[model samples]
Target: MSSTASTATSPLGSGAPPGTERRWLTLAVLSVSLLLVGLDTTVLNVALPTLVSELGASTSQLQWIVDSYLLMSGSLVLFCGALADRLGRKWVFMAGLALFTAASVAAAYAGSVTALVVARGAMGVGEALIMPATLAIIGHVFPQGAERTKAIGIWSAAVGVGTVIGPMVGGWLLSGFWWGSVFLINLPIGLAGLAAAAFLVPNSRAREARRLDWSGAMLSVAAVASVLWAVIEGPDRGWTSSAVLLSFAAGALLLGAFVTWQRRSAAPMLPLRIFRHRALAVGDVLILAGAFALIGTLFVVVQYLQFVLDYSAGQTGLRLGPAALALLVAGPLAGVLLPRVGLRTVAAAGLALLLASAAVLGTTSPGDGYGRVLTAMVLLGAGAGFVITSTSDAIVGSLPDRDLGVGSATNTASIQLGAATGVAVSGSLLSDHYRSALAADPHSSDLPPDLLSSAQESLGTALAVARHLPGEAGPTFADAARGAFVDGLGPAMTTGVGVTALGIVAALVFAPSRTASAPRDKDAS
Candidate 1:
């Protein structure tokens, strides 16, 4: 085949470019689909307490319910991106939308923690397919320049918007209906996106037919799953236990093997050469760190508001509005500034803000009230907005046209992996510290062994046990539980500060000083 024949075809049929109106409309449809994917990332966060009461979920189970979706999506996105490149972006996107909608129904009616977790994993599969396709389609539809940058900024903002809005939506739903309503709400949105996408979204795929790297795909998934399993289960199962140790060892081996295979494969799932792009490398790290801070903080704060401060789900959602608003505002603003200011300044500033946010949150005490937390949320939101928008633009813009599918997938995988890690690491630290504090408390010594064991499982369980106790003992035990939870939040926030500080340093040192020049389409060379 001629080199010219090996480039991506125009998304619009018959080589007629889509009109500006159609291009923006396509962006709208893609953004809404992306919104659903992003919404799922945090929608379940507010519903976690309800799940504890409704499904009798342990802390580990709760982490699993959230991380399972993240894990599957993060791990499989590359493979799905490859499929979309070969088969059709539109086809994979529609299929994913349909599957995600169906999985939402299954998740809504799930009767047990195990069932709900399974349903969530299924949803993750759908997300893996949808996330990359949307970005790749955007790459196909929009030319690389200011126009594409603006579109990508809007696309990036949809993620932040979805994530921030999730708690509010879930809170409103949980206020009137069962927890299942959180999942069920996706039905109308998903169905509408699916139908609109069929007509509005144009089809595109790689002109060159390359062999898919199945071996690399499997190794990547297994490695991630093993590492995440160890992280999530380590607190409950004992970090030094044979199973945890084995998982860590296996993950390391699988990761090394994956790297070796990719280097040797005829058609690697992820081309190692891409990381040579400084902006792309730095962008992925910054994006990952930003996501870790934002999502991890949300995981802990939502629980803190509800479990400690006695806020209802609706109230908790309302309180979180400042962060969402800040993010909504900052995202577009970052886009407008990127071409003028350069990525280095914008990205470093964003990470600096996140570090400051984490530092503030680390000092939080039960008596600090909502004011302190509100300040932290605003910083977190604005920081994440700048980081996600600027870095997403950097990552996507750095790639050659041929690499857009897998490149976008890798970009998004960084996000999901970071968010998943945030939940696992934050929850583990919280659980381990809470358990230790509870064990050390004098109030815990008076409880029965079985009750003590249950209390050690989670703050919610501890509070429940305290409620059933007699007289002053009940209130004292509850106070201890609340104190322990507050103590646990410190370590998680401290970790975030450390991570953000590192990201700030990296961004300042490595990120490019100027906006991307133009699309070179290196494949043409």
Candidate 2:
């Protein structure tokens, strides 16, 4: 889609344009759609163990059930954002909601692990379209600065609210029903959202009338798909497997070609020019770093609750509430706090808090106190809330007005890609350490490989097992697993610390001066 297209106009120009009532209604409906998408993405996490038992899923398959959704959702943002602009934001957004509802119904009734994973992937595609388009609509609807800021706040709040409730809802459902109920829940909400959205949102289109960047979009999809495929499969197959090598090579080649083509094309899908603003660049990088740590933490923490604490899915969800409350407070507090201190100062403080929180998390032993874990959770949530809100504001504020949707894409894509990378890196680290530690132990001979894999996958879980195994063997395994996970956590947290430190430095040295206007064109990047 060309930059020439207008972002807002009636699909039928003569119709009454949307008013404040309609705008808020549209936001409400879109927010629900967002809530469903966000909830679906994370809710399945608490139900994974149950799903595995019921469906006879393998380690790789379980990973796919989570990862395929994330991978597709992350990869499709570039094209989807352009599609919203070219086709009509309202049209694309509603279509996504409809698709999502249908897919969720299919996911609920899935008979096998393969079917469930495929359904989740389809749901992810729906999610990719809905999110950026909704954001773009927010930008279009709330033209005034104060109103827009408030709108963004509401949008960000929806994320926190959705995240907090997702596990709790999934937990409650999984307790009485099957794991399928988590996906099943999306059906009614999606339908209501679809109905509400049709009446509320105004139609919008890109100003620049030009061809869609078909080549760029396809290349981008292939590039990201190939890379994600290799990264995901690498631990299962040996890293040097011929298929893995080919996937990696293809991903790199396609990605490089996409970048090259975008630079040369008259109407690029993902114009390289967006990277020019130092504030935007630094913000994008910092957003990725924060997401990396946060996601990696989530993956490990759930394991701790289920495996180490011996908590049921419902119990695990309930335990996460304090952290969620902390997150709820932090976004508003950070907005109040950020401008008072510079962005660099506030972000650095948050990252420092995160590093400290991770260290505290490493203190969990075979049967550690719950209070200590809860405190760590609060600190992590507070820090993450600050990081997410602050970085998001900086990225969007720094972008030129001409590319609002594209800017939104850059922000969302950075988040999705960052999350994808974090999961791969953190999961790989924990998996490798967990397996090696257990196999090296003298008593691991009787343990099945899958049992060992599950134990190796999380410290909390291993700790839980250690509490129950015959003849003190379980405790011994748990102790080994806890040690291995801590070892992995330290390095991952260290990487976060180092990256955040660099972001702080970059923000101070390279960010645009306060007096400067948002940059566009070649100078914009």
**TM-score list, all predictions:** 0.95, 0.86
**lDDT values of the candidates?**
0.87, 0.69
- For model 1 the TM-score comes to 0.95
* Candidate 1 Cα outliers beyond 4 Å, as residue runs: 1-21, 518-525
Model 1 — which ten-residue stretch has the worst lDDT? 12-21
Where does candidate 2 stray beyond 4 Å? 1-21, 446-502, 512-525
lDDT tens readout by residue for model 1, 450-509: 999998888888889999999999999999999999999889888788888888888888
User: Ten consecutive residues with minimal summed lDDT in candidate 2?
Assistant: 516-525
Task: Report the C-alpha lDDT of model 2 over 85-143, residue by residue, as the tens digit.
Answer: 77777888998888888988899999998898889889878877887788777766654
